[model samples]
Target: MKKSPRRTFIRDTAIAATGFFIVPRHTLGRGFVAPSDKLNIAGIGVGGKAEVNLPFAWNNGSDNIAALCDVDDRMAVKARARWPKAPYYKDYRVLLEKEQKNIDAVIITTPDHMHAVQALAAMQLGKHVYLEKPLTHDIYEARTLTKAAEKYRVVTQMGNQGSSGDDTRLVETWIQSGVIGEVKKVHVWTNRPTWPQGVPVPKGSFNVPAELDWDLWLGTAPQRDYNPAFLPAIWRGWSDYGTGSLGDMGCHFIDVPYRALKLGYPVSVECNVGSVYTGFFQEAIYYESYPPSSITYIQFPARGEMPPVEMIWYDGGMKPPRPAELQPEEQMGELDGGIIFEGSTGKLMAGLFGRKPTLLPLSKMASATLPKSAFEFVENGSDGHQQQWVKACKKGYGAYTSSSFDKSG
Candidate 1:
C-alpha cells in the first residue's frame, strides 16, 4: 500500500525544518486516520522506573520511540531490546542535538538532579514533555520547569500516576461532601531507603564499570568516586544525586491529598530525624546522606473557608501513631506505608498510591451513602496517566491532564 502523504510529510518535513515539525492542517486531508498521528517520543534515562514509564507511553498507541538515551548500557539493556530500531545514545545532549527534528516529545525519567536541565532543553526546542514525578530535585527547578512549560506552550505531565487515579477524586468528593469535615491534619508515611542511608560516604574509589559513563552518571552532582552504592539503584539515599525517600516517593503519596484539599505551598516546616551510630556517645550526621528516618511537619495556611492544614511526612520505617479507631489486628497501611487525614467530624485513610481508602471505625465507612462526584475520570483509570498526556499532546497545550506542571509543580 502507498504511504499516506501526511505520514511522508511528517517524516520528511521534520528533518528538513531542522527542529519541531510544523504539522500542516491542509495536508491532513480526508481518510488520514487520527490514530495514525503518532507523536515521535525520545526517552532520556530509559531504565529503572523508566522500564515501566517508557512502556506506559508506548501502550498509549500514539508514540513512536524515535530515540533512547542512557549513560549506562547495562541499565538500558531491557529498553534497548524493546526498541532495537530506535537509535541509542550514551549522552542525552547528543541525542537531543542529533535528533531534534525527529521527535515531537520527550519522556524524562533520569535522576532527580538531571530532570530539569534535560526537560528544559527539550521544552526549549518546542517538544512536549512527560517528566517523572517530584517534578524536580529542588523547589527552584520545579518553579523553573513550571514556568518554561507555560512560556513554551507545550503539553506537560508529571509522572505521578495517582494524580490521574479515582482515589484523589473520591477523596475530593468526600471532603467536598463534608464526610471528612474540615481536615486539619494529614499524616503520610513510607518505608523507604530500602537502600543504605545515614552512613559515611564510601571512602575507596571503585573502578567505573565499562558499560557505564561515570561522568555522565554524576551529571549535575559534584565530582565523586564511582561507588557501587551510587550506581544502578542506591543513589536514592544520597543527597547529591537523590532526594532521599521524600524525594523518591513524595510525589506518589502526597499527590492525592494535595489535589483533594486543593493545597497551596507550606507556610513553615520543622523536622526531627532519627540518628545514625558513628562513634562512642556520638550520633552520626552524614549530611551527604539522608537520615535513616525523619518526621517533617509542614503547616499550610488556610485557603478561603478551609481550615489550616498540618501535613506531616514520615519515612524510613517510621510512621505516625496508629489511629485509635483502627482495630488492633488491622494494618495501619500496607507494608510500604499509607496516608491518614484527620478531620473535625471523622477520619479517612488509604494505602500508598491512595488505594483502599476507608473511613474510621469501619461503621462510618459502611453507613456513609454518597454519590460519585462530577470529577472526570481517566478513561482507562490510573494506568491511563501517560495516555492522558498523549491525548493532551495531540490536542495541543491547555488540554486537560490531571497533573500538569501548573498543578503538580
Candidate 2:
C-alpha cells in the first residue's frame, strides 16, 4: 500500500501548528474544516496597504494570520488593534527566522527597495508570498524574483489587483474583436506626487521616534539620517527608497495594454522630466528625489499578427492629448489617472484600477453590442484577488494565478 501524500503532508505539518487554534469538526457545521486546512499567514509592512490587504486575507475564512512585522510601531497601531492576538516584530528578518515553523505563507506590502530581499528570503524558506506592485526597484531584482518563484516552486502573486478584474478581460476581448482595430499606441497618465517630490534632500535630521526603528526602516537602502521626509509614505517620491511615479503606478496601468495587446518586454524607452528649482538663482536637479513631473515613452515590438505598439506614461499632472472622439464636455481621465488605448478605428479607455472601460465617441458604445464575454470574471470579482492567492496556497503550488510573479516581477 502506498502512503497518501495529502495525509503525509498534514501529519508533518501538525508539528508546526503548535499554538494554532483548531476548530473541532463537529462544531464546524456542515463544512467541517480542520485546522491543518487553513494557511498560517504572516504580514510584512503591516500598515498602509496592509490595513486592507491583511483583512482581505482573513476574510477568505481559510487563512490564519500568525504574525506581523513593521519597522515603526506608530504606523502599525491600527493593524495591531485589529489583530491583537498575532505576534508582532520590528524586523522582517527576525520574524522569518523565529516564526518560520508557524507560518505557511507571507504577505509583503513593504516599500519598493525592501521588497526583493524580504520576498526572496521568504521564498527560500518555502513560504508562498503575495507581494505588492512594482515587484522590484531594479530590473535585475525583477528578473531574479521571477526566476526564484519557479526555482522555489512556491505560490506567488503581485498586488496588482487589476489583474483579477473583469474590466481587464473586457479590454482584451474588445481588442481581439477588432472593434478597436489594431492597438498601435497607448497613453497612461496619473496625478501622483500628491506627496513631495523633485526637492533637495532635507539637511536637517531629527532624533528617531520612540515608536520607530530608523535602522530597520532603512532596510537595504544606504544609511541616512532620520528624516520625516522619507517616512510615512513620502519615500515613494525618493530615488533611494522608491521608483518614482513610473514605478509607483506603472504596473497597474501598463498591465492593461500589456495584457490586452499581448505585449512583451519593451525594446526602447525615452523620457523627459521637469526641473525642480529650489532657489531664485539655482535650479535643483535633486537627484535624490523624483521629478515634480515627467513623461516616459516605451516601444514594444509586434506580437504574432499584432502591429508594433508605442506606450506613453505621464505623471505629476501631465497628460497626453485628448482624443478627438471625446466630447467637449467629457473628461479625459479621472483626477487620479486613466489608461487609453488608441486603435486605427477608435480608442478604449478606463480609469484607475482599470474600472469602467468605455469606447470613445459615446455614440459607438451605445449602438454597438458587446461581444460575448470571452473571459471569465474572477470569482468574487476584484476582492477575490487576495483570496485567489490564498486558495492557491492551500491548493498547493502550480495553481493558476493572474499576476504570478513570473509575469509581473
- For model 2, the stretches where C-alpha displacement exceeds 4 angstroms are 1-36, 279-281
Question: Which parts of model 1 have CA positions greater than 4 angstroms off?
Answer: 1-36, 60-62
lDDT of 1 by residue, 66-155 (tens): 899998998899999999999999877678778876787899988887888788878877778899976888998899889888877788
Per-candidate TM vs. native? 0.90, 0.90
- Residue-level lDDT tens digits of model 2 in 1-409: 2222333433332343232222212343311223467878899999898887888888745578889999899878998887789999987867877787778789999889888878877877778899987799999989988987887778899998888988888887888888889889999998887889888788885888999987677766776888888878889999899998889888888888888888889999999998866678778787888899999999999889999999999999899998898889998878789999899988888887677888898678889888855988888767889888888876666878889987897
Question: Which residue pairs clash within candidate 2?
Answer: none
Q: Give the top-scoring candidate (TM-score).
A: 1
The local distance difference test score of each candidate is: 0.81, 0.82
Question: Worst ten-residue run, lDDT, model 1?
Answer: 24-33
lDDT of 2 at 111: 89
